[model samples]
Target: MIQKAQEFMNENHFADVSRVQCLLRKMMSKEYHGLIDQIKEYQDPHAIFNIHGGNNLIAPTASQAEQKLVEKPADEIKKDKE
Candidate 1:
């Protein structure tokens, strides 16, 4: 069933994320706890995001960016406030 869902996602290039999430929720609800775990193992977030078509780019390092932001001088902050 998960494989079929994945194939459907691939075939429908413009599928809606909310709809797919809803369908997955319904499937999960009808199953027992053990089956739910198996379903979760099969439902890969990266694969789903890729199917929905994301920017395949790696994101900038957040810690580095935050460090740079925090390291800004008081003078620089005041200048920007002008």
Candidate 2:
């Protein structure tokens, strides 16, 4: 399964393996277990969704959309300056 994922990523020119790993980890969470199971049983692991710059390939999901929101660190918080 991992091998097929790697091949799919390579074939699609996915440059961020770490990002993909993070996404996979999130998908494996209990909250998404059912979705993962369904995907594992039916979807092709090699399927790719080309996004941003045509270099970033990702599986489409709500979490992927949520990840776009940039988070600010504690030190960078505006209230910290006050």
- Alpha-carbon deviation at 38 in model 1, angstroms: 12
- Find the 10 residues in a row with the least total lDDT in model 1: 33-42
RMSD each, Å: 16.0, 16.6
In model 1, the runs with Cα more than 4 Å from the true position are: 30-82
lDDT of 1 by residue, 1-82 (tens): 5445655654565686457656776765544323223322223323322211343333433334221224455356446645
- Please give the lDDT score at residue 34 for candidate 2: 34
lDDT tens string, model 2, 18-60?
6655566575655443323322212234433324443445644
- Model 2, total clashes: 0
Residue pairs with backbone overlap in model 2: none
